[model samples]
Target chain A: MIQSFKMALKSIAGNKLRSFLTMLGIIIGVMALVILVSLVSGATGSVTDSIFSLGSNLLTVTISDDKGAPINLQTLNEWMEKDGIGLIAPSGETSATARYEGNSGSVTVYGTTPPYETINGLSLLLGRFIKSSDVDNHTNVAVINETAATELIGYTDCIGEEVSLDGVKFTVVGLLEDDEKSLTAVFGRGSVVAYIPYTSLMRLSSEATSNITSFSVSAETDMATAEAAVTSLLMERFDQDDDAFTVSSRDMLEDAMSDVTSVLMILLGSIAGISLIVGGIGIMNIMLVTVTERTREIGIRKAIGAGRGVILQQFLLESVVLCMFGCAIGVFLSWAVLRIISVVVSSLSISFSLEWNVVLIAVGFCFLIGIVFGLYPANKAAKMEPVEALRYGG
Target chain B: MIDLKNVSRVYQVGSGKVYALNKATLHIDAGEFVSIVGPSGSGKSTLMNIIGCLDIADSGTYLLDGIPIEDYTETELAKIRNRKIGFVFQSFNLIDKLTAEENVELPLIYRGVGKAERKARVAEVLERVGLTKWSHHLPTELSGGQQQRVAIARAIVTKPSLILGDEPTGNLDSKTTGEIMEIFRELHEQGNTIMLITHDQEIAEQASRIIHIRDGVLSEVSI
Candidate 1:
């Protein structure tokens, strides 16, 4: 058995070009499998992290038209006072240019109530968060992220300083810090985030109470009750016969993202698997040709005492060796590509992780492919009559 | 000793049956140097295959050392081939990827010899064949005569009772053929049973007795 295996290995190595070509299919298949799974998981990880940071207990309520455009906040506010509700935040987002002295930069202005900061997991790097008094008093105070403060005020003191938004001055009350590098691009222009009183923002944007962009709500203790209360409240507020608003908890959002990623990974993996099948066919074809070329050798080996099992083992081992070689190359290439992608998308929280389990699965698949395809040729080689094989090319 | 009461092999070729061997009967005791000589398609190679346990006769009985051949399964026959028989081919059918020593180690490997013993026996066989110096050289790297010697070394590595040669010197030059025949003569003198198959009368004459076949039927021709 050992002798047969050694001979098979030698025979495969004898034809370097053929062996390499046979491995190419497996290489591509494994590479595709690794890269696709890595990318999908990376994206899913970042998204899930982002959603969790938004506070799992909190739910966002947006008053929107049938086509999903924001509607009146007055009606949304009336609905929030319903039974089983705890807290509701009507938030508005706007893009505007902020200038301090000569330097000017684009900033995303999030106008909301005081509860918005706590609900969204925002931390003040300097000064204080927006207070209830600020909303009531319609204060012209602004809390800006480190990026916005830096861009608008340079290295100068930002707290108590005034930053002009489209020539309208507002006093900087606090500085906010970004959680991850990914937050900058996802939130808006770079890391520029500014928070102002909702009343002031509504006055500045010149919109009526009808323009309620979004609302963030938290359930009152019981989850089942919260779900039922929120759904019914939204239904009643919208005056619709059916459910209209998209109300999802943190768990639901995470699950949806996970499902999407799983499907994407599977699709990509199947595409890679197609290449694996092609690779298996390549192995089969080469092995069959090898069996033909070594017909006389096969006969001699059989005559010298190699049985059907030994012959089968030899051919099968040759194919498996080819696949294993390809698997190594493919894994290496996938990791290299993932590394390059990681470097390129540094700001997106994208990371590629190699799963050894996946690699083991790939190896097993390669072996199976080899054995499945190797059966026919190996059987043919084993069953060859010594006399006929000896006379084959004589 | 080898015995054949009656042996026949019929092959399916297209729509009709082709009889490769027809009701052949032969016998040889241990230590006999014999030859089966016939033109191509004359059943000499087929008879050799049957004798080597590489193929079974279609009908009738064959006994090698008093054991029935037809009743043995392919695997059992493989064990017999590995244990009792060695074969040298006309083309010097050595594995191209293996060194001469490795090729010699093959049969022993199938016999489940330990690595150390297999290596020692392979070395002994290579030395016996006078190719110990080329033990590390692959078959393709060696001359045809050297490769044939390696094949001979491989065949005898396991110390089998019989050595089956199918036109073993067909690919060698006259000098190399003479050299191989000399090795065969030494082996025969050493009490090793040899069955040489050839179409060449010159080669057949070197054997102690010649058995001829024409159109799948045996005929005796004394040399």
Candidate 2:
């Protein structure tokens, strides 16, 4: 058996070009699967990590009127003293054009108090976080993301610089790095973000209203009791139906992200699966031809003393070797693609991990293709009568 | 010794039955050099195939060394062919991808011989066939006569009891023909039972006895 294997290897080596061509289908199939799966997994892992990094126990609560009525600040102030919620950071957000020097880019200005930074896990890279005094005194101080800061001041410290939004001057108190760059919205193609005090923002902006766009909340330690208490508080404050607004916990958001990613992965995997089918068909086609071409050789071997089993082994081995070599090349290509992707999306922490089980499954599928495609040829070769095969040529 | 008792083979050829062999019975003792001479379709090749265990007789008792072979399976027949018989074909069916030595080692490979012993035996057989110098060369690189010698080496390397030649020198020149006959004469002298099939009387004359076949029937003549 070992000797036959050596002979088989020599035969394949003898026809290097033909062997490589035969491996083409396998190469493309494996590469497609590996690259698509790794990319999807990397994206999924990044999104999941970003959500958890925002603090797993975090929740968001917002109250809106059924008829879209303006929020009454007096009622909201009473609700803010609700018994169940431990922390609430109301935020008002709007989009505007910002100009720094001669370069201009569109940016979203988030209006929020100092408590919003701690609730949303925003940290300062330079200087300090937004202060309660700044919000109370209605100071026009801003905390910008690293991207915004870099664009406005280059590498110079922006701690004392002023950035103008719509010709309104705001002193830079701190620079914050955007974590949501990793947890991007569906249609958001990465934009710069700047933050300022909600009171100052409301006073200067024309579209400002008492209607709060959203609020991040940290419920008391007893979430069940807090949920009930907050529900009644909102009902009393809004004086409307119980279902007037929506409240979502971090776990719920994570679950939704997981579902979306799972569907995406399945869709991508099926797309990759088409190539494997093509590859398997290619193997079957080549194997059938090989059997026909080697019919006389099969006869000669059998005439000399080889059994049906030996003939089967030789051809099956050839098929598997072709596919396995292609799979190896595919794995290498996947890793190369990931390296390129990481370079392209450096701001987002996306890692293409190697899953051994997935690789093993791919290998198993390759072997199955070999055997499934090799069956017809092997049977035909095995059933050949030695006398007829010897007599075939003459 | 070999025995055939009422052996016959029939083939279904498109609504017509072709009698390849017709109830032919013959016997030969050990170490006999015999020839079967006939034109195409005369069943000489069919007889050779049956004797070599390449095919089974339709209805007959073929006893090789006192064992009935018609009852044997295909695998059993292959083992018997490898151990008891060798074949030399007119076209010299040496595997083109194999070197001369590797081609010669094929039969021994089936016999489950160790690699060391197989190599040693292959060298001895190649030397005996005057192919030692060309042992590393492929069949395509060798002359017609040399390629036939490689085929002969491959046949005999397993040390089979009987060597069957189907027009072994049909493709050779007259001069190469005489050289091949000399090798046959030497092999027969070494006590190997030999059977050859040919249409040429001059080639058949080299054997000790001749069997003539016409339309699938055989008649014997002393040579």
Candidate 3:
């Protein structure tokens, strides 16, 4: 076996470029596999992460339209304080540019009640969050996230500082940690956030503030009953008009995102897998050519005392080495490419983690490709008659 | 020792049976140098191949060292080839990818010789072939004569009991031919049994006994 392995190495070393070209297919195949696994796993990781960060059991209520009699805040609050509801933090949002000295960036100005941070798993990194008295007084006070602190103020711990937004000065009482899958970015230029009293934001609202974007509600018991209660409460309040308002659960969001990811994985996996099969065929084609090219050599070996088994072993091992070589190259390329992309585009929230199991599967597939494609050519060389093979020109 | 009785081989050329060998009987004692000389397609190669355990006769009895060839399985025949016979071909079929030392190690590797012993034996054989200095060169890097000597080193590295040379000097110049024949003469003097097949009469004359094959018939000619 060792002898055959040595021979395989020598044979490959004889034509290094040709060997690499032949392995191009395997490289592409393994690369596709790695990329596909990374994309799916990375997307899934962020989705599940966001869902978990929504705290233990949470429901989001959205009044999509508020043209007629608007949603009564007191009625909604009283209903949420009833059976399955543990807490409610109604919120509204508007896009505004925040300025502190010369550092001005677009930010999402959020209007919310107190329990927002506790229900939504948000933490104060430096100072206090918005309080109920601030909401009742309609104070021009703000609790800014890390993005606002860094992008506008250029540093952390900007507690008790004041930043002007939409030409109104608001005190930054708290510095909340940045929400890692930033939903605020979906509304504005991203990287800056501020939360003040809902009444203060509503009083300054233009046309966009008529409807609430969403308000988070924690379940007193579990998520299922909270979602059901929220759905039914909205259904009764809107005269059983299900389309008037929407209620979504963290579990539902997770399931939807997971389903999308599954479909994405299958589609990407097959496209990549097809390329791998193409690469395996490429290996087979080259191996067959190699056997033909080495027919005379095979004859010589056989004449000089090589058995059929020995010839088969030598040829098979040569192909196996070729595939594994390509695998190593492909693996390195994929890892490097993924690392660069994640680092260069840090805000993408799409991480490219190394999936060892996927890599192992790809490696194993390389061996399978080696054996399946190599057997025919190796056997062909092994079965040749010495006299006939000796006469072969190549 | 080698024995043959009424050995024959038939090839299907298109739709006709061409008998490359026909019931040609011959014998050679242990430690004798014998040559079979014939014109091209006169069954010289057929006879050598059969004797070298490289081909099976359709109908005949062949015995190598007292074991009937027909009784052994294909794998057994391979073992017999690996263990007992050394072959030198007309083309000097040294694998182009292998260095001279690696080429010479082929048969010994097949015989499962240990690394240390294979190294020692390969050095000794390369020295015997008078090409010890070129032992590390690839076949393509060596001259024709040097390549043939490497092939010879490879053939004898296992110290195979029977050495069969099929037109071993067919591809060489007259000078190189004489040099290779001198190596054969030295091996013969060392009491190694050697069988050579060639179409050249002068090459045949160098052997102690010459046998002629014409139209698939074998006749002994005193040398």
Candidate 4:
């Protein structure tokens, strides 16, 4: 077997250009498989990380129909005191134009109470989040993100500065720190955003209502129990109509995202696999030519006492070695390609790296292809009659 | 020792049967230097192939070293060829990509010889053939005589029982042919069984006994 491998290497080395051209198909196929799958997995990983960074223990509740029992600030406070529920914050949002001195910019205004900071994992760089007193007194105060502060107020330290929303004045009491690794940072790069007390938002924007339609709840312990408690509460509030409200946890979103990405990965993988099959066909084609070209050599070996099995093994090993070499090169190139991609998307903080399993799959697939495609030609060479083969091309 | 009884090989030439070998019977004792001289298409190669275990006769029994050749499987025939017969072809059929030493080591490899012993045997045979300095050169790099010498070395490397030469010097010049024939004469003197197939009357006269074939019939000619 080792001798056959040596012979295979010699034959492959004997025809450098033809061998490389044959392996090029396999190389491209493996590159496509490894790079595409790794990119999807890397992107999915970063997205999941960012989603968890937003707080996996948090549940988002949206009420399509409040029915008769509309949730208010008092009701949210009461729900927070319930079992498995750590904190509950009523949230509503509206797009409004904000002006400070001569600077004006459009911003998304999220209306929520103090616990919204912890529930959503938002941190303030200056001042404080909305206190319960602000929500109760309907205070005209707003907390703006770093983008809003820098864009509208021209600086982050502009705390206590007055910014007008649709001609209504509100004091900017806090500035949010910028988190470039967050999902919002990636999807909402240049957008200005602000947070105000839910009561104040209801008063300032015509689209914002006193009835809470959306809210976020953070679990004190197990998320499943907390989700169950919230669902039952909504079910009771909406007269046992489960469809009146939908309570979604971060786990659901994470699962759905992974499912989508996995499908995408398979789609990409099989498409690349097709190219690999094409490459295998290329190997078969060249191997056939090689067998025909070296018919006399086959005859010489046979006449010198080589058996059919030995001849078959020699040709088969040659093809498999060719494929494996291509696979190795493909994997290395994929890693380099991923590195280039990582550098390109460094600002987004998503690093693309080669996954080991994908590399293994590529290698295994290449080996299989080698055996599958190399068999016919190897068998052809093996089954040739020694006398006839010896007489060939004389 | 080799034995054949009523051996016949038939070929279908467009719905017509042509006998390549026609009920010919022959025997060669151990250590005998024998030659079969025939014209082209006179079944010289067919007889050589059957004797080499490269082909099976359609009808008849061939025995080499007392084992029936027709009863053996393809793999067994290959083993017989590897251990009992060494073939030297007219074209000096050395694989172009392999070095001379490697080509000489082919039969030993098929015989499952250990690497060290194969190397030793190959070196010894290369020295015997007066091509030790050319052992590492490829067939394309060697002269016709050197290439033929390498083929002879390859044939003898396994120390096989019989050396079958099918027109071994057919492509060499008269001087090279004499050189190759001298090597055969030396091997025969060393008690090796040698069978040389040739069309040259002068080369056949060099053998201890000659068998002439015409139209697939063999007749012994005392020289």
**Which candidate should be chosen as best, given TM-score against the real structure?**
4
* Tens digits of lDDT, candidate 2, B59-100: 989999888998888878888988988889998888788899
Give the lowest summed-lDDT range of ten residues in model 3 chain B: B70-79
C-alpha-based local distance difference test score of model 2: 0.79
Candidate 1 docking class: medium
- Per-candidate local distance difference test: 0.81, 0.79, 0.84, 0.91
Judged by TM-score relative to the true structure, which candidate is superior, 2 or 3? 2
lDDT of 4 at A302: 89
Clashes of each: 2, 0, 0, 0
Q: Write the per-residue lDDT of candidate 3 for residues B29-110, one digit (tens) a residue.
A: 9889998999998998888888988889999999999989888765567788888888888888888878999999988888
TM-score of the second chain, each candidate in turn, equals: 0.97, 0.98, 0.97, 0.99
For the predicted complex of model 3, DockQ is 0.58
Evaluate every candidate with DockQ and list the scores: 0.68, 0.65, 0.58, 0.77
lDDT per residue, candidate 4, A88-118, as tens digits? 9988999898998999878889899999999
The interface root mean square deviation of candidate 4 comes to: 0.8
In candidate 3, the residue pairs with backbone N, CA or C atoms under 3 Å apart (3 or more residues apart, or in different chains) clash, namely none
> For residues A1-394, what per-residue lDDT tens digits would candidate 3 score against the true structure?
9888988988898899989999999999999999778967876786677677676677888887544646655665787677888888888888888889888888878888888887887888887888888977889999998877887898887887889888888988988877776443322346577888887898766733535557888888988888888888777667778787878887778888889888887788788778888898888898999898888988888887788898899999999999999999999988988888779766666677777888898899889888988899899989988778888883
Show where candidate 3 strays beyond 4 Å: A63-71, A96-106, A121-177, A181-189, A200-203, A206-213, A221-246, A347-351, B71-74
RMSD of 4: 2.0
